[model samples]
Target: MKVVAIGGGTGLSNLLRGLKKEVGNRIEDLSAIVTVADSGGSTGRLRKAYHIPAPGDIRNCLVALSESEEIIQRLFQYRFKGGELDGHSFGNLFLVSLMDITGSFISAINVASQILRTKGEIIPATTEDIHLWAEFSNGEVVEGEENITEYGKTSKAKIVRVWIEPPDAKPPIDAIAKVQSADLIIFGPGSLYTSIVPNMLIEDIKEAVEFSNAVKVFVVNAMTQPGETDSYTAYDHIEAFLRTTNLSKIDITILNTKMPSDVVLRRYIEQGQEPVIPDVAKIARKGITVYAEDLIGESQDFIRHDPDRLTEVILRAVSHALS
Candidate 1:
């Protein structure tokens, strides 16, 4: 199976980690198309200074796919405690430095992957330096991925549309080709608006996905994101994708059946978040096959999708699709 996972941040990274362990032997090709619209924290600083795409998500994905020594991975993930480089990750700086030396972001990533002995390929959705812009229903426009999330939280209106700057920004050819050739295309398990949707905002990437012959799967989030997806249900998540992209339908939608413990639920509720209700009927009405399962797992009191369980479910789905 040639699997292509799309999205950004920890969700995509975690998914890659599990897939690396489960499907690496079965499939020789696994590629991740990560969003690069981030404009906050260390990534933002590096982007501004060097005029390059965000490297934070790429670094995370590289480390997740790494098969190197434990110390190498730890060192790559190390963040400075305090000083001028406070909150900056060693991996991010290393990638940026490689970009400077190689004169190409893609080349820099290739070098980093070799250094980490990564199991699969990691590709950015676009090589251009881009920023995300969101327009709310109330006519408020927020620029930058970081600002869009923060602004969406306090706004009374819902996001009407989102696009990338330089509306004609081209996606990396390799990214589009990977989607065109993928046997399975996965979306989400990340922030809906900022992380996942930003990649779709690119015309070529979205078009390739819509036209792909692969079984398209969307991994619904276990919990609602406070700023971006407040009060969003499983059906709402799918609807948002349909509304934003030219894709007519998704083949399968994976919904988490288990809820967190009361204590964990309480903690999330306190933070203005709640478990995403699996509205199976509504989602099924859209002609999507709903695969509901006990996919929830806790990590340090934080509710997350169990990586191993998720991989199992996905593999089963792929088998069923093929059979």
Candidate 2:
């Protein structure tokens, strides 16, 4: 099976871990198309100084697929304490050093992948250092993914459109070809604007997804995000996807069925967020098949997708499609 997962951050990494465990050798191919719009934490600092595409998400994906020792994985994820490099992550520094030595980000990633012995391929949506620009419904334009989340609500910025500057930037040819040849394409369980939608803003990447022969699926978030996807339902999530990209209906939409404990729910509410109480039947009525499962991975104050359960649901959907 050739599976191509798209998005950035922990969501995609966690999903990859599950897929790796479940498919074993039967999965002949796996690839990730990660968003490079990150501008926070170690990645943000590195981007400011080196002018390289953010490596945080890409690094995470690499480690997730690594067939390496736990110690090596820990080394990549470790963060130094209380120094000039205090805020920088070990993986971020490793990637920058590799790029500096190799003189190219793509080549650096290739080296890193070999060191980790990752089972799958990973590529950026674009090799260029591009920023994400969002035009809100109120006619105000937000320039960066990090900035969009801080805009106040009365601002009424509806994310009217998103585009990459130097709009002619092309995605890595390997990334585009992977999408075109995918048996199944998956998007999101991550931040709507920052992760999934940012990748779609790259014209070439979006075009490849539109032209792919694979069945596309969106793993909807279990909770609505504050500032970006506030008050959004399951269907609203799908609608936002269509509004952002040129693609039409997604073949399958996965929704989390198990409600989180009240303690966890309260903590989320304190943060101005809430579980996405989706009208599942109504979502199905919209023509996209909906699959409900126990997708929540336990966390201290929040809930996330259980990598195993989430992967099971996704593989089942893709398997059904293939059949």
Question: Judged by lDDT, which candidate is best?
Answer: 1
lDDT of 1 at 251: 95
Task: Please provide TM-scores, in order, for all candidate models, with all chains considered together.
Answer: 0.97, 0.95
Report the Cα lDDT for candidate 1.
0.90
Q: Root-mean-square deviation of each candidate, in angstroms?
A: 1.1, 1.6
Which candidate number maximizes TM-score?
A: 1
Model 2, residue 60: what's the lDDT? 96
* Model 2 ranges with Cα > 4 A deviation: 152-157
lDDT of each: 0.90, 0.85
- Candidate 1 lDDT by residue in tens digits, 161-264: 88889788898889988999999999979999899988888899989999999999999999998778889999999899778765787899999989788888
In the range 1-323, model 2's lDDT, one tens digit per residue, is 88899999888998888877745555778899999888888898899898889899999999999999999999999998996989788998999999999998899899999999998888998888988777787888887777777662446456767777767877899998899889889998888888888888888888888888898899989988877888888888888888887676688999987789888988888887788876788888888888988789777655889888888888888889789
